[model samples]
Target: MAAAFDIGLIVLLVGIGAWMIVVRDVVVATIIFVVFGLLMAIAWVRLSAVDVALTEAAIGSGITGTLLLGAAARLKGADAGGTRLSFPITVVAAVLCAMISASLAAVALLLTYPAPTLAPMAMQNLDQTGLGNPVAAVLFAYRALDTLLEKVVLLLALVGVWSLAPDRAWRGVPSLDTTVPPSDILAFFAQILPPFGIVFAIYMTWTGASNPGGAFQGGTVLAVMWLLVMMAGVMRAPSISNVWLRWLLVAGPALFLIVGFTGVFIADGFLAYPPAYAKALIVAVEAALAVSIAATLGLLAAGPPERMQQK
Candidate 1:
């Protein structure tokens, strides 16, 4: 029964994804893509990877979906159907992909390894790091250099976006169409939301050391808060071209890399901290990442950087 359910869900997800890819209406496609992410999360849960499922739900279904929908809205009625591939070409591509997938699956099933794994090695060292969760230990303690490099990649992406951004004079600011008075109920809600969101984001980041929460989750919450502030006319998204804003955007990843390199001088290896300070280092990195991610995602949603004054 479980196998059957998993297969059914997989088929459903594949159908939805294909539909989204081929749909002419961008908005509808974005909505379908969100649904596809949710189904992917469920599939991950069924596969017993709760952590991955949480990430898929948060980053995939939540933030990525929101980004896609916002972009679709902005590009509505734009030239959307310029490229076309014949049915024969698509069929050939599908056959090639299926063959590759089957070969990969076969290789995976045939692989053999020693028992009582390196996981135990990681588990034994867990106490030294002060992180209760082994995954967090590996991410922040054992393989922190990798995490730091990943942050660099994110920073590079932000830089690439800035480089591609239009000149300040040609850039347009996003406009909100609502007209709510200061004393209105909606205005009251808007005015009260930012602080609550900030509090929630901080709580999530602090709790991440021992819990399921992490920098990405906390950063996303903060991004939502920033978005709310912009929507409510309390704050405006900063221009991407601003030097100060660019520095702020890169600071998290830059700090992470610096700390990783500094670790080599302070401890046994690059990104390896003294056992006593691992937890603190992880928290600090996460905090910085939260701020940087919030800024990056908010700006991505805001489109091109432009000179604009908040009303």
Candidate 2:
């Protein structure tokens, strides 16, 4: 029965994904994509990867879907002039996609039984990191560089987005559509839910060392809350030129770099921590990174600022 349910879920995901591709309406396609993300999250949960499931639901489905939906709304009539692909070209693209998917499926089916894993190795070193969660240990100690580099990549992506802004609108405030009335349920929830959201974000960041929560998930919650407030017109979006805002955005990466280099002088090498201070340093970095990640994601979703600041 469990196997049957999993199979049904996979079929639903595939059908929705195909519909998203073939649907001409942007809004409908975007909604379908969001559904796909949610279904994927459920699959992750069933696989007992709750950390990944939270991230998939929050950043993958929530933030990304909201951003794409907003863009689709703004681009309502902008697709009228695009050139259509020829039948031959369309068929070629479809064939290429099918071949790629088939290759991946083949790889999955051919994998070795008992599934080689690093769980044991990770567990062995987990105690040294003073973190109860093996996943957190890997992220903050065993593979700290990989984690730091991921955050750097996010910052670079944000820079790339900002660079695309028109010169006239550079350093301006992001313009979000806030036409929703104050008495609407959206606005009411936005107002009432943020306090609880903030508490949840903090709790996730704090419990990450011992459980299936982490900076990314916590940061995503913070970002979603901020976006909600902005959407509800409870708070104005910060200008790109705001010094404090930029500092907050970079705080995590900056602190990570500082801690990384300090390790070289005091410990084994870059990103290494003394066994005694491992958990402390990791938590400090997570806290800072959570704030930075939240700010960065919020701005990224906001896209390049479009409205000039009023004098």
Candidate 3:
């Protein structure tokens, strides 16, 4: 039954992908895209990759889908329907895509019976880091540089988004569409859900060393909760120029960098935590990263500034 279910899911996903491509309506396509993400999350879980599943559900589907839906809403009727490529160009593009897919399939099929992996080695050193979850150990201990760079990339992406603002509204408040009145239920959920969300986020962060959850997953939850509150008019979005907000925006990556440089003078070098304090430092970094991630994602979703800041 489980095998059948997995097969069915794969079929459904393929159908959804096809529908999304053929559906001319941006809104409908975006909805399908979200469903695809959710299904992919389930797929990841079935594969025993809970950490990936959480990230996929939160970032890939939830936040990214929201961003796309908002873009669709803001761009509704703005698409003048740009010129389509010539038949030959379209054929060429399709052929190239097919060739790439075929190459990937070939590579997968030709893999060694027992594919090479570093899981055993990673697990062996997991204790040294005092992290129970191999995924967390790999991220913060095995390849800390990559993790730090990833957070920096997110901040840079947020900055790129902010740069789109006009000179007049450069440091102003992001403009959310307030013309439509929010439903009472939304406001109610905004109030109640956030407390649970906050607790869950904290749990996810704290237990990440021993479980599948981590900073990005928890941070995304906080980000989504903040957006919900803003949508319900429970709180005003912060201005781009807000001092406190700016500090939060850089706190995660900045702290990560500082730790890296400190490592240069101290232990093994560059993000190397001392044996006694490895878990403690990792937790601290995750905490700071979660805050910055939440703030950055929330502001990114709120879009570029549209009006002057309120006094």
Candidate 4:
């Protein structure tokens, strides 16, 4: 029965994916893509990879879906018509791709075997690293340099977005004609929500050493809080052209790199924290990253940043 269910899901996924690609309405296609992502998440869970499933549900379906919908709205009424390939050609291409994928999967299933595992080695080093989760230990202690570089890439993307922001002098502060002033009821909710979100974000970051929560999860929660505040008009998106805002955008990655380099000078390896201070350092870095990511994502969603004056 389980095998039959898996095959049914794969068939459904392929059908929906094809429909999504051929759909003429961009908005409908985007919604179908989001549904495809959610279905893929369910498949991951069925395969017993709950962590990957959670990530796919959250980042893949949730965040990406929201972004795509927003982009579709922005592009509405714009020139959407384009060239198309013949249906027969598309069918042939898809068939060839599916055949290749099936062959690869068959080979993998037949040749795969139980291999020597690294769980024991990771467990042995866990005590020295002070991380209860082996994944956390590997991410922060054993392979921290790669994580640091990934953070740097996020920082670079933020900078690139800022650079491409519309000229502030010519555009000036954006008129908030569409932005409604917050009512007392909305303000009340905003006040009550942010503190709770902050507490949750801290909890996630601290508990990440032992459990599923981590910097990415905590950062997303922090972003939610910021989004709430912006929606309530308690805070406005800062102008990207501002020097201080730019600094805040890069602060997390800059601090992370400096700390990692310091480890190289002190411990003779990149990102190697002193044994006594590793936990504290990791916590600090995660906290900073959460703040930076929250700010960057909020600004990105707000479109180009603009100068705001006290009302």
TM per prediction: 0.82, 0.94, 0.96, 0.79
The digit string of per-residue lDDT tens for model 3 on 51-86 reads 999999999999999899878887886863568889
Error of 4 at 121 (Å): 3.1
Summarize candidate 1's per-residue lDDT along 1-311 as a digit string, tens digits: 99899889989998998898789888898889888888999998897766567678877887788878867876776766556889999899999999998999988777775524678888898888887767677778888777777767766665564555456533335444335565777667767887898998888777877876777778878887877777665665554446777677787887777777888899886777788788888888889888888887776665554444344
Kindly report which residue pairs in candidate 4 clash with one another.
none
lDDT of 2 by residue, 69-95 (tens): 877876886873369899999999999
List the global CA lDDT of all models.
Answer: 0.75, 0.91, 0.89, 0.73
- Model 4, which residues run further than 4 Å from truth? 1-19, 39-51, 85-111, 115-117, 168-178, 184-192, 306-311
Query: How many residue pairs of model 1 clash at the backbone?
Result: 0
Candidate 3 regions exceeding 4 Å error are 178-183
Candidate 4: deviation at residue 212, Å?
A: 0.3
Per-residue lDDT of 137-246 in model 4, one digit per residue for the tens? 87788888787787777766655645554564223332222264566667678779999988997787678777766776677677768767776767664545567766
User: On a 0 to 100 scale, what is the lDDT of residue 256 in model 3?
Assistant: 84
Off by over 4 Å in 2: 178-185
Candidate 1 residue spans exceeding 4 A from truth: 1-11, 46-48, 74-77, 86-92, 107-118, 170-189, 241-244, 306-311
